[model samples]
Target: MRLIELYKSVQGESSFTGVPCIFVRFAGCNLRCSWCDSTYTFQGGKPFTEDEVVAQIEALQPCPLIEFTGGEPMLHERELLPLMQRLLRDESRRYTLMMETSGERPLGEVPTEVHKIVDVKCPGSGSAFGSFRMSNLDALTSRDEVKFVLRDRRDYEFARDFIREHLQGKVAEGTLGGILLSPAFHQSPSPLRTADNMELDARDLVSWMLEDGLPARLSLQIHKFVWEPQKKGV
Candidate 1:
């Protein structure tokens, strides 16, 4: 598998936020979002075998939470699927697995045991806008989560309409795991650790959510505030 740096860090997004987790950041992406921070993962990464990757994961010790993230981990599904299975099926120590993906990929074959946190690109995502694969919505089990990175009211509206139009039934049935609306961060945020660095204020997003009574969680990329906004890894 083409691999970027694999390290232990707290999960900065999703319902499992703030939990200590190992991040497996893979290289290469098919889509480009304007607010993307991991553009460095688009290409050029060291290659490692599945066994080697597992070894690296084991080195992180008793921490059992692992997340497969990337430019797009599903793009390397040929390798990622097996890796996830290995972690879940480990006889000595089983790991709770999660994946953060751009929703542009087909998730039909992903193991249901792995929690999927999918991103639904908003209009402000530049070329990535409206790129989510509608069919992937069918694969969302109660263990999965959908996220929308908002930059403005337009983006929020898009996310709102999508949930109302297509996800209403699953949400009402409690079959969908969660819906997260995180504000976008400036691609090049200042080194300062402050809310001003954020492209959209969380307060504004919360207000909008309150006004509409949207059944979505207000997610902030907690890792950004915990470290330098542009820092790699956690």
Candidate 2:
């Protein structure tokens, strides 16, 4: 596995926020989003064999949650599936595998057991040119989710409208996994708290969701608050 870093941390975003999770952050990404926080993952990282990666994960045994994220996990196509399969091999592991993706990759190759958190890039991310596969929506189970990181009012508007136009039916029935609308944090110079980490305000964004009647939830980077943002591990 071409890995950037592996460490244990509380999940900062997603439905599993606050849960202690072992993160497998891989190097390299196709998109250079304006608010990309893990810029460190976009370049050089230590390479590990699939077995080595799995061993590191098992070392963090009790976490029960493993997140495969990246500069873009999908970019490392060859190793992802094998790593996931290896991690899930132990029923006793009880590990809930998750991956954070840019939504630019084909979901067909991803193992069904992995909970995919697909971040549908909004206009403000500067990756609007990237094609999002509409067919991938069908592959998402209730355990899967879609995410949109908002940068400003324009981003919020785009997100709100996107949900209304392409995602309303799913939101209305509450059958879709879920929609997450978080403001872009790295763009905000003023840190939200003493943590000195850039991040979005959960309350402010949640209010927008309520006012717009959007089904999306506000996802804040809890780990950012608990630890230094630049730090690799919890």
Q: lDDT of each prediction vs. the true structure?
A: 0.91, 0.79
What is candidate 1's lDDT per residue for 39-72, written digit by digit as tens?
9999899999999999998999878989999999
Q: Lowest-scoring 10 consecutive residues by lDDT in candidate 2? A: 189-198
Q: How accurate is candidate 1 locally (lDDT)?
A: 0.91
Q: What TM-score, over all chains together, does every model reach?
A: 0.98, 0.90
Clashes of 1: 0
lDDT value, candidate 2, whole model: 0.79
Give the best candidate by TM-score: 1
Candidate 1 wrongly placed segments (more than 4 Å): none
Q: Tell me how many residue pairs clash in candidate 2.
A: 0
Among these predicted structures, which one has the highest lDDT? 1
